[model samples]
Target: MTRPGFSAVSVLGVCLLFTLSGCSGTPAPAPTTGSASATATATATASPSPTAPTSQAVTPSPTATAPPSSAPPSSAPAGPTETATPTAEPTFTGFPEQTGPLTIYYVAIGDNGVSGPMIGCGDSIVATTTAPVRFTDQVGPSLGTLLVNKSRDVGLSGLVNVLYQSNLTYVGGELVGSTINIYLSGQFMLGGVCDIPRAKAQLEYTAMAASGATSAQVFVDGRPIDEVLSLK
Candidate 1:
């Protein structure tokens, strides 16, 4: 009643199992290596760190440059330039109390020279022995008024009004025949003229008049000259 050593049922079951395994054509899956897994884990961790490092910020140092100066502004210059100095005038000697008696002659010459008895340099009278004196106007206006035309005369006929004066020059103290001179000025109001210096001619003497006339008067140099010629 026991089955033979190789039972057909058992054998048929074993062959069927082998046939299914061959027809499925499946192989065993390979096991994962430890090194490969470790490499993969490192790569994943490094990739995530790339996005994280960009978060921090950087700064600069202290002690840079300095500022500008604190000084004030400037000022201006001062005043104008200056000029030069001036000059002075002239001088002469003094005079006497009275002039003594003297006789003078009048002479006629051509057109220009001294004319009657004139006083100059001192107290005496000096005679002009020439005709019409060509005189210089020394004061007032530079060129002055002419009282008379250039003409012939025995006496000085022009009248002069002294409007101003130069410094007084001294004619010496009077004696029997003291002589003197002067420089006068003139400007013509009535006529056109040039200036003349101590130019008028007259006779002067210290003799008392016989006609009860205290002062003497004479017609000379074409003018009536009234002069105190005496000490009476």
Candidate 2:
């Protein structure tokens, strides 16, 4: 039991120092697992981000509308209706009265030295079935005998006197057997009785018509016209 150099106090000190050094050393960290990393990624994916505010679209309404045209404008006026005028009837004004009964033909000058018979209407100039006019009562100035009265009836207008003179006299007519004599007393003789053939023909025709004789004789100024004018 006798240990020489080793004392009890030295051994006890060395053992206390070794116990203090072991208590001061740090401990090792634990290892990470794959399940813990997957859990954290899923938590971030499931969470939703904040949403932006929604904008509403606004539609505008029309302001003006056009009017319909069923009729004409109010500024213009309508046209007037057309009407027809009535025609007037004719009236008889200046026509002469048709009196008497007989119609006889007498000679008168026409245009351009022409001569023809004109009608003379009288009561006693010529004979008719409805009215008989005695030749003795046929006297004085009348149409176709002395003066042309009804000129329009023979295609002439107004009064036309072939024997026109200032102071002429028609000395009546006389029937001497088959020959008829008509007398005249005036300076206004028809073409000197011979120089004018138209005048001679007119006198002869008038004389025949007046007396209704076969041969017509003319006497001017109490002398026979044939003897005065030297007519064959």
Candidate 3:
């Protein structure tokens, strides 16, 4: 009897087909076309991208700079500065020379005429010559020229000398510092009271002028001229 569905040979043939299919390599699954395709898309989206060699961004360091100076810039043109000049000193010279004709003082009557006191007599100037290096040496000779009694003897007229017959002699004259000292040996004779001052004026004026000094002291016979003149 035959089965209702398949014959025995057919059934065995079907079994053999299944066995061979199983022995073969596993069959590729059919291309997903619905829910499986969706599942594969989700897995691909969840995976991380192949980072492109992961190039690290290198940050460069900042450049250094110098700070600004506080000083202001100069506007003037550059050049050499001027310096001050020194002053020169003055030159030195020597002392002055003293040489010339000497002056002598003699007695002369005043405008009041000869009737006036000899004390009121004026002075007359006379010139004499002597070769002397110093004023002291010139004084003696100048005084000697003055001792003459008459003014006419010295080439002058109208002038009188109270020492006419006085016989006063010039001994010497000396200058110590600024002072003038005169020595004489004589007999002072005054004819009248006025003759005293006349004699003093003649001797003192002549000595002072010759010595170029302001004052002079006269000595007669080692006595002061004041004492000798006063005795007259």
How would you order the candidates by TM-score, starting with the best?
3, 2, 1
Clashing pairs in 3: none
Question: Using Cα atoms with residue i matched to residue i, what is each candidate's TM-score against the true structure?
Answer: 0.15, 0.33, 0.45
Give lDDT per model, in order.
Answer: 0.32, 0.49, 0.68
Model 1 stretches with alpha carbons more than 4 Å out: 1-12, 19-33, 41-50, 61-232
> Residue 62 of model 2: what lDDT?
81
lDDT of 2 by residue, 16-91 (tens): 8898878876756654677667876787678866788679776788868847665566677545545779778888
Winning model by TM-score: 3
For residues 80-134, write the lDDT of model 3, one tens digit per residue.
6568798888775533455556555444656343432234434333334334444
How well is each residue in 1-232 modelled by candidate 1, as lDDT tens digits? 9776978999999999999989897777766797778888988887765555655676667877746534333354333444656656555343323323222222222213444333332222233222222322211111121122233243463323221231222121122222322222222221111212222222122111111223332322323322211213
The list of candidate 2 runs beyond 4 A from truth reads 1-135, 139-144, 147-162, 165-167, 189-195, 227-232
Q: Pick the candidate with the highest lDDT.
A: 3
lDDT-wise, the better of 1 and 3 is 3
